[model samples]
Target: MIRIQHLSLMRGTKPLFEDADLTLNPGERIGLIGANGAGKSTLFALLRSELHADGGDVDFPSAWRVAHVAQETPALERSALDYAIDGDATLRRLQVELEEAEAHPDHAAQGHRIGELHAALADADAYTVRSRAETLLTGLGFSQQQMNRPVSSFSGGWRMRLNLAQALMCPSDLLLLDEPTNHLDLDAILWLEDWLKRYPGTLVVISHDRDFLDGVVNVIVHIDDRKLKRYSGNYSSFERQRAAQMVLTQAMIEKQTRERAHLQSFIDRFKAKATKARQAQSRMKALARMEETAPLRAAAEFSFEFREPASAPNPLLVLEAVNAGYRVEDEATGASTERTIVKHINFSLQTGQRIGLLGVNGAGKSTLIKTIATELDPLSGVARFGKGLVIGYFAQHQVEMLRHDESPLWHLAKLAPDVREQDLRNFLGSFNFPGEMATSSIAPFSGGEKARLALALIVWQRPNLLLLDEPTNHLDLETREALTDALAQFDGTLVLVSHDRHLLRATTDTFLIVADGKLMPFDGDLDDYRDWLFKTRLSPAKETQAAATANAAPSAPQVDRREQKRIEAEERQRLSTLKKPIESRIKKLEERMGKLQARKAEIDAKLAEPAIYESANKDELKTLIAEQGACGRELEEVEMAWLEQQEALEQIA
Candidate 1:
């Protein structure tokens, strides 16, 4: 268990949390939620002891093991396996001892040393460690070839997987993870959600992924206004409770206001009467003692209005085998090459239809969006916009177009041009920019703020059609919900490419899955499209060797079948006679392994202590090392036997 007491954290002059308390039980999975900069990450960092709070303490059992996965993967050159195995100090020591024993098997005291090494190894389950590492890597979508590859070769997203795999492999008592699903593709995210559901330890995760939170976590802890609120269930349940509480709060505030007004009228009408004056005074005191209602702040508001062009028509844009890609040229050599990222994507945007594009990472979702938005042309095929359909394009990289020196207000005015300065500020304020924030330069804004600014600029024009590419990237929970709500209520047609499941489910009634070298239109939600993708693109056919092996033995002839049936009956009888003995042996091995592991942990704790430095510097150190070495050897032998027995059981099946 972990407890946070009277926690107060201040960033610069702003107090993030004041007198806040939070707790986590042994097996509870908590979803840490809040608006942007509401201390979700700060609270996590404090719990992990990475950041010190202004005042208060984080309490945890001294024996508990904790692991935290940061938002960004560390820049390291280690192999993936090395990175993961380093997470467990005990396991690493065991490996070191085993490797030493293997290297010097023919030494002077070989027999005695090998015996000790075998014991220590078995206790550590060193035999299964490599297999477990491989399983975890494969489960995270990495191929066998990549397990030994240097971590630096992988992209940032894959590096995140390495970080996540490391944290998960550690057998910690508590896990602190922030945005574990941020860079993961849909399949990887789903796999993680499933893994977290079965995780044995306590979990505290700060994430904006709604689907993940709903499926994995059992509780939601919300931090707001420097106060903490705990909910008993998932994000959906939390939202329902919050909305119901808001309604009740509003009703109570209204009732209090009416009563206060009535008391004021009574005081005015009967001030001359002493009895009535005393009664009025009592009413006034009651009103004064009542705590003012803490009204919930309205979530950020977003609305897109597209200005319909009334002029010329012939479709707004057209593409005919118009190949578009960036050319890379070596200035010294004067050599250039064009790499075609996307090709033969034939699509059309009509006057009234909105299209939602779907694809895995690097599946040309952005490229398709760019082509349709007229930022790039298709390699082969015609992409034509309908007549009088003016497009307000919001690319995933639109924030890059902003000038660093220009404030958001100034940027908005420069982009829209037609809107008055006052009107532009009003529009910007809707996306949570107000007062000094509106006047702040684009360089100072966070990623989410920059995204909101880009969105505000696009909508100010109010074109007949709106194209949004990954619009919810870097947004917090509240801002994302607001953006989804706004998109759902938009009157103009919209083409969106996003991994936001909630937004896609709510806004997209149709899906265009880009797979098999083309865009295929489907009429349904993401789940339906996923099912289609699995059958068509994701799944590979069974291996020819496995298929052949499965059919190696053809169905037996009549005489062979009779003989086989007789043999099966005799085997069944023999197995029935031996079942009790086998079961008892398996149970005994498990109990013995458990006791050895307990003893191993005791020895590990003693070896890790600083007492060796103060006393028994050399001889005691060698003895402890030998004892650890013995434990490692035993652990390996026991695990190998267990694996053999398990395999035998499977073979019997």
Candidate 2:
């Protein structure tokens, strides 16, 4: 449990929280929500003790462990699995000591110490730790082979996944997760949601993903007016509750409005008269102190109609035996090799048709969408587009492609040189970029703002076909919902690739599964698609492998059924043999971890006392701190070893 009493906090003289009192009870999963820059991150900093409270106190058990994902991961030669397992501070500590003990060539003495260390490793469940880490890695979209890859090999997004896995790797009483689903696809997000629901610790997650919050969080902590308002349920419940409160408040404000107008008229008529000056002044002070309610600024509405295309063409697009993908170039040899991402995709789009693309990550959903958008030519067969076909393409990269030095006004002006400046401003205003914000450079804009600008640019052109790939990546719930509303009303043909289930469900009428290197119509809704994911796809790696085999198999196949079955059985047996030792190793590690964790708890208890820090026991305090630190290093080492075992198991699976 954690307690905050009249707490005040500031970020560079800006008060983020003032006289804020809140309580976080044991095992409560709370969703921290506010507008961006409303100090959600600052609140996390305060909890982490990186910032001191300006007033009052923040109190929690000193022995409680806190875990959060690191924002950056340095490029290193360490394998991804090892990096994740390093989150267990205790496991690493024990492993370090074990390494030293094994190195010292003292025969009987070294043997005894090594045996004792392995026992400690067993206590920590150190053996299965590797398997545990790899499970997290696999769930986050890493393959068995990728787990052994060096950290430096991955891109920024994958590294973020690594960082998240590391945080999840750590055993803690309190878990602080901020936007954990940002880089994840729909499938990964689903897996993570399930994982979080099973977590036993007190969890505080800060995310703009409303559906995710609804799925996992039980409590909503909203930061408003420099105060924390705790709501009893998830995001949807909070919305309904807030809406009801607003209605009641609005009713009272109507009566106050009448009173304010009467007082203002009285003061205006009497202030100039010398006889009424005292009374007017008294009224003025009363006006200042009156419990006034300001009108609620209506929610910023991103409401806009997509200008209908100049001409509607039947069958806007047709893919005839299309093989869509890329020709890869070998960097060193300057040799090109054709790589087919999606094979023989026979997809078509008609006027006003809406299609939602669904598949696991890297299943060529983007490839097929790109081919239809004419961004990439089909490697084989024909892609036919109707007359006057105009495409509005939205990709994840377009937001970063936005010129930081330019204003939203400038972006629109460039797209339409003939349009009047006022017209452009009006259009931008509809996107919620009003007043000075229209002219201001977007260098300081948040990701959601940049995305809106990009979408606004797309809308200005009035394309007949919309190709959106993960357009809601950084949008807040409000903006995403607004986009959903707009797209639902759009009169153009739409092909959208998004991990946001709510947006997909609301905006699309048709679904296509981009799996097995094929484009096939899915005769199901979003809920049906979820069921399909679990039933058809066992894992992301298997899905990709199956697709690759289907696309790359010989044109004339010779293998018989019995031969294939015999091969599969043999391979399964080999993997089973390979996994046995690894599983044994992980089990031993877990047992070792359990013991070390108990010992570490005892050391923490001693360190928690005030007398230990006093001059009377300074030496004892130093000795205890050192012992605690040593235990931490060993635990980390054991966890790393355990991660290797887990990676091996995933490879077999």
Candidate 3:
């Protein structure tokens, strides 16, 4: 549990939290929400002990283990699996001790130490830790081969996934995750949601994805006006509760205003009258000391609409047997090759159709979107557009192309030189860049600000077709909601590739999946897509191996029935008899290991109780500790036997 008392924090001169108090119990999953710059990150920093409260205390039990994802990972030569398993500090320590003890075989004390180290490793289930780490990598879309590769071989986004896996590997009482899904694909996001639900520890997640919050968190903590307020339920519940509270807050302000007016009136009437002077001064002091209730400030209003196109295109674009990807040519041999990512994709969009592209990280969603946007050419077939079709493409990289020295006003004017300045300014206001912000250089702007300017420039072009890929990556909750509303009202054709489930549910009418080097229509909603992903993707490694074996297996010619039956029966009987003993031993060992694990877990729960370590119960505590050690040693012996048996079984094959 954590306790915060009269906490006040300042970021430079700006007050983030003033006199805020909070209590967070163990095993609570909380979604920390606020507008950008509302101090959510600051609060997390305070808990992480990177920052100190300005006025009061933030306290937690010293025994509580805290875990958080590393913001940066330097390129390292260590294998990804080894790096992930390094998160378990206790396991690593025991492993080092065991190695040293085994090396010093002449020492009697070292022999005893080796047994203790092995027992400790067994208690942590060290033998299966690699499998657990591999599962995390797979859930985050890493191939099995990648798990064994050096961490330096992965790109930035993949490195972030490795960091997340490492954090999840650590055993902790409290876990702090900040924007965990920012670099994830839809499949990874869904996997993370399920993982968090099963995490039996306190979780504080900072995210703006509404649907994700509703699925994983049971509580919402919002930061507003330099105060922290805890809501009773999830993000949706917090929204509803905050809206009602705003209304009530405004009503209280009005009542406070009336009371102030009444007090001033009495003071004015009684002042300068000898008999009433004393009462007048008292009333004056009372009026001065009374605190005025601040009026509620409504959320900022941001709205925009796509401009009408110069010409209407009934069918915005069409793909006919298109192979979308990179085209390579060999100059020396005069040979050409096309590395097709999405092959034989055929689709067409009407003027107002809204389509959402869904797939795993490397399943070609982005490649298909780039091809549709004309950034890449089709390798084999036609990608035809309707007459007078104009495209507005917004990929994540588009924000980086803005001229650093230019402002929003300058960029819009360059697109439409003849437009009136007032109209341009008004349009910029709709994207929340008003007056001076539109005129000032955007070199120092945040990612969200740059993204808004890019969209504003696109809308000003009156594009009839739009292609967006991960447009909500850097957007805050308010901006994401604003973008969702704007897209919902868009009259032009839209094609979006995003991990945001809320935006997909609200804006897209059709779902297309780019998978297995093909683009196909998917008849389902986001929920159905999630179900499909889990069902089909849970055992990707097995499927790949099976497919490989199927392709490589030898084909036998037709033979006499008696000959085939005789050969098959002999092989079956031989393999069964050879493998039975090893298999039986493995099964018995596994059963014994399971019972030992259950007993260990029961002891762990009892050990966690504070009263178990009291003076009166010291003997009981010592006995329990000895029992736990015995169980660990037994489990270790069973695991060793099981492994040897499994090896023998594999040899029989």
Candidate 4:
């Protein structure tokens, strides 16, 4: 187990944690979550012994080995597999020793040393380490051929994947992963989730992907208000528990405010009167002894909506035998060749439709989205757009296009130059850029901030069609939730390509599978997609049409239009009927829980008073204690009932 006690830490002048305490048990998968600047990474650094705590102690078993993904991967000529294999320091040491022993001049001593080295290497499974490294690379979306390529040959994002694979290749008792899903596609993310679930060591991951956290973590460690809070269960459970706590805190704050006001009023009215002077003095004393309840401070606040488009057009875009890809030119021959990605795509994106693009990395999801966004022209066939169609496209590279020297306000103003400056500021404020942040240069802003700015600029355009490719790459949980809410309520057509399963499920009603240079409608949800990925062994080399269809759920037979509409309507009605009562029950239980918690708090506060323990108030103290216990039991029952209702609602949904 790892124990962190009275752990005070500071980043320069800023205090990140003060007297924080936490205990992490062995083999526990923990999701470390916080706002963008809440020192999550710094805590990881402290755990890795790269940074020391200013006060208190962090202790763990001395023999435990820790592994973490390196932040940088230098450009090297070493094969990718070789670099990943080097992650096992013990194995590398043994290999080096074996080489030295073979070169030794003393024959007898060298033979003994070589024999010992061989036994150690066999014990360490050195012979199979290459295969293990290859598996890690494959799971991370690398091809078999790519495994032999030099580490310097991959791009920055692919290099990060290499770094992740190297970390996973390491043998350790504790593994630390910081945003491991940032560079992964849906398939790779799913694979990583499975891999982490099977890991035998303690795992601490800092990720904003809620589904990923829920799938892999058994506990959540939240950093808030300069303290570490441990919660049992997954991310969803942590959310429910935190929300209930907030509600109880707010109730206590309100009760304290009322008590304070009542005492103040009494003192003001009778402090000078001879008849009630003693009572007024006593009230003042009670007021002075009362503990203050601070107002709730949210970790982050961000909410924005896509403005209603000026016009809505049916069949907003059409692709007719479209081969969506790019053209490659030969410098020496002065000849160009068209490289097709998604071929023969015949589809129409209608108004108010939400579609998610599903595919492995490099399988051309981005190419299809780019084609629809008109960023890339269809190489072979005609691509048509409606007369009044307006496109608002967001991609990772668009974030790079943002001017570093410019402010959020400047970006918005440039898009809508005629709008009022205050209106623009208000718009930027919705994306969490308030006051000076709106006007300050974005040069020093983090990637999340830059992504938010890019999104704000897009929402301001009021486009009839929204095309997003991995828009949540740098966003934290709060911003992602805000974006999810906005996208769910959006009235425009949406075609999203994202690895975030939560966002994909929340905002998309349909899915399109991009594979083997073709696009097709997928009739199932994310779960089915996961099964298909596993069954097909998703990789660039194995991505064939036959393999994709082999494991896919059978397509439903076509029916009459009227019959199909009726079936869909009936299903909707049935779901609504099933959901309504569970939702109502949940609401009622929440109300009851709040009242019970507030009453319990009031009783506890009264019992804490010194006068309550005196002989005169002994009976009243006993009554208060009895009532507190009853309230506690009732609260637990109501909370359990609420949990059941929530589970039912989720199932119905």
Candidate 5:
């Protein structure tokens, strides 16, 4: 259990928490939520002991091991797998000690030390550490081949995933995750949800994703009014509870206002008269003694709408046999090469259609959106835009394109130079930029602020078509809700690619799955998409390819039923034939491991007896220790072989 008592914290003179108290019970999955700059991350830093509270008592069990994702991963030449496995500090320490003990010259003196190290390794389950690390990496969307690659080779986003894997690999009693899903796709997010659900530790995550919070957390700790308010149940439950509290608070405020007015009226009427002077004086004292009920300081409300387009044309855009991808350049030859990411795409956008793109990361959802936005021309096909068509595109790069030295007012004015500065400021205010913020330089703004400014610029355009790719990235829950509401009410056609399930479900009426260089309509909703992802993961690559190809072209020639069955049978037989020897090898290894483990246990039991330590039994102790060391080594070798065989079986599938 963790207890925070009279917690008072400050960043400069800004008080984030004043006499705040919270109790976190063991095994409780908590979601820490607050407005931007509300010190959620600061609280995490305090928990990690990276920051000290101004005045507070933060107490937890001293024996507890804490784990958190590192904010920055230094570029290194270490293999991704090795880096992740290093999270198991205990296992690594034991292995290092074992190596040192074995390298000692005197076998008699080192025998006891070697035996102890092996026993510690077995207790830590060190033999399976590699498999555990690999599993974590795989769940975070790393391929087997990629797991062996140098950590420095990955991009920033991928490195973040590696850091997440490393954190999850640690055997921790308390796990702190700050925006763990930011770099993850929907599939990986779903996978993580399951993993965290099964974790036997206390988890506290800070995230802006409502759906993720709803899926993973059982309690919500809201930072509001310089206090930590704990709410029972998930995010939706927290919203309901908070809403009810706000209503009650407002009612109390109104009631107190009426009472104050009544007291003032009585006091003013009689204070000048001698007859009621005593009563008036007493009433004045009562009013002064009354505890004030402060008015509710509501969060800044963010709301905006898309301006109606000048024209709404049927079939706003059309793509025929389009091959959408990037043009790569060979550095040595200085020659550009076209690489199609999404091929044979036949898609159209009509007025008022809301479509969401679904796929794993690197499945070309961005490519399709880019192709439609005209950020990239189709490699080889026709992409026609209707007359009077206007597109409002929002991507991460678009946010980066904002002039850092300019204010929100200036950015809006650039789009509408004829509009008055006040009117433009009003528009920016709707997106939460008011007063000095509208005129101040955005150089020091956070990512969420920049993203909001970019979106504000888009809403001002009133485009007939909206193409948003991961627009919710770096956005808080409030802004995301605002975007969802605005998109829901927008009359223009929309194609959105976001991992935010709540926004997708609320705004998109249809979903298109992008996989295997093909895009096709999914008949079901997000839940079905999740099931499809799991099934696809379990399926063989060739089968997945075949399914994608069949879905892409409805008119493709189909194999006869008998021929298809025959081919499948033959494929199954071949897979089984290849797996037989590996499976046999794995069974033999398991048996060997079991026997060695049993023998080691017997040796341990004998070693625990007092007689084994007697001078007369010194030689017996040495013999037993040597046997124990040999057993541990054989067991480790057998486990590795078993893991290899399992991988081979997976490859055959």
Candidate 6:
């Protein structure tokens, strides 16, 4: 539906595209991938006709509708549903005409106008538009009630989603999205991916989400050094193809370099020979005609050596009866209260298992991860670190802590202490910070750059236990895959909170979910979780959207002394009602932990018997050891719950 012919685009002095040609056909899902500022978004703009190319033609089919969703949204006062439903202005206008025609048949132009209005309304499917609009809105996470709420009340992230809904609902033959998944939580992102996959039209999306790209897109278009390269499959396939291509390209360059060197050496020796003068001259011309092959940029590989610190074999982390949350008070009445975000989450980890933590945003996933990593005492429970375990944390906010005065090179020098200069550059280059980019101070680095640098730092540390929260944010598909591969190879225990479905599935075998103020297990793939969400949360008979958003409820308003007392009394009564269930869950988790611990101890004793390893009946020992290890990990998880439970019990007391 859209094509770029001999297109060239420039931003200031830099040429982003040079005689680059590309095409997007109906129903094609194309993922635009490249380094930052490599003109991925610029190319989208040119295709959408929002930006003019410096040269060449952008051929688009006649009457083709195009829609673009930008990174930032504008001010909108309409409700999210209204904003989405208004995707088709022509349809809306047609509806208005029909309404006018129905109400004012006696007007001067009634007969002719009514005929035209009838045609427009029929063409627009005006009768079924409301139901269609509701489906689009609700699928995009807006509740039925939210259809009338002011969009201005929603945060920028939600506004972006509303904008996306608008784009999707439009009469577009092709859709262009720039970093569309940046602000979405995992659930909303999965919803969009599914929508796009089943969408009848074409889509070209720019996203840092690797899983989304792999799941929805069938083609990959990479823009690099003013050229467009196409791959035939998803991101993972594209990666393998790219690697193979790079190898072939490097070999071609190497062969050409060798031939040129040999020719030059011969020319150098035979320049004055009368018999070889003609040959030397011809070789010189050939050398002049040979196009200079581009050198392969080095990949970033952390070359720093690390020594795993000596640590005990006990659980690397422990949480006992923890209560997590914040303090809240009714301002009007000055009635203070402690709000529990989640209570009675207990877990412990040894040196081997990789655990994935999953939850919807605001479900207290980060709070639990942070409380463990930073060694903060649980609001009511105890958290203890195992003996000698060296912890490395990569929080979402960790990138902001980099010192401004230091360049990527200097940061590596200080952090790794002994990394060679060339090795440091190569490492930074792999993360796409090649050459001078590595020397630039961290102060001016973009969000993606900071994230890459933080990842490099964490990888370089090689700690025995790594705690990573959203480490895949701002990463390209290739880098995220690389990280997953590296993590799979890592011997250390990993506890990570991530929204990247690909990363979670690749690196972790166990899942812990935080929801409803409790810890639960999710024994399925990311797609399975998504399916469950739509079934449970977005079922046809689900509550209206507006009701749900409103139910999150605003804090109590200001009140006089008597009102304050009344509010306090109500809060106390509500807490009393909730206290029983919270207490019950804590007790159950603790009881489970005790039983697992007993099983673990009995297996451990059997494994330690002198003849266990040498016995001809040795298979029994292997099974016992495996069972003991499994029981040990389960016990740790239970302890984490026990801690959370104890905290909840104290709060109720």
What's the TM-score of each model vs. the native? Answer: 0.71, 0.78, 0.80, 0.85, 0.81, 0.71
User: Mind giving the per-residue lDDT tens digits that candidate 4 earns over 275-389?
Assistant: 9999999999999998797765677567889999999988898899999999999999999999998899999988889999998888899888889888899998898899899
Which segments of model 3 are wrong by more than 4 Å? 105-109, 266-286, 328-336, 417-426, 439-441, 539-653
Q: State which candidate, 3 or 6, has the greater TM-score.
A: 3
Better of 2 and 4 by TM-score: 4
Candidate 6: worst 10 consecutive residues by lDDT?
Answer: 298-307
- Clash count per candidate: 27, 49, 0, 0, 0, 20
Positional deviation of 203 in candidate 6, in angstroms? 1.2
Per-residue lDDT value at 214 in model 5: 81
lDDT for 262 (candidate 5): 88
Misplaced by over 4 Å in model 2 are: 110-116, 258-290, 293-301, 536-653
- Output the worst ten-in-a-row residue range by lDDT, candidate 3: 538-547
The full ranking of all candidates by TM-score, starting with the best, is 4, 5, 3, 2, 1, 6
Looking at model 5, report the run of 10 residues with the lowest lDDT sum.
535-544
Q: Considering lDDT, where higher is better, how would the candidates rank from best to worst? A: 4, 5, 3, 2, 6, 1
Selected candidate, larger TM-score, 1 vs 4: 4
Error of 2 at 362 (Å): 0.9
Give Cα distance to truth, residue 151, candidate 3, Å: 1.9
Cα lDDT listed for each candidate? 0.71, 0.83, 0.84, 0.87, 0.85, 0.74
- 1-653: candidate 3 lDDT, tens digit per residue: 88888998888889898999888888889999887888988888999999988899999999989999998987999999898998888899989888888888576867777888889999998999987887788888887678889999998888999999989999999999999998898899998887887899999999979999977886788887787788755687577657655755665666667778888999999898999999989989999998887765656766677777787688788899998999789999988888989888888888888999999878999899899889999888998888899999998678778898999999999998998999989989888888799999999898788988898888888888889999888788888888899899887889999999999989999999988888988876886677567655744364465456567748634458687557745765687789788778867876786678667666755675557889999999998999999998997787667655654664553
- Candidate 2: worst-modelled 10 consecutive residues by lDDT: 534-543
The TM-score obtained by model 4 is: 0.85
Across 19-121, the per-residue lDDT of candidate 6 in tens digits comes to 9988777788899988778898888777777899889888878777888774566677766666776887788888787778768948766878878887877
Roughly what TM-score does model 2 have, to 2 decimal places? 0.78
How far does residue 473 in candidate 6 sit from its true spot (Å)? 1.9
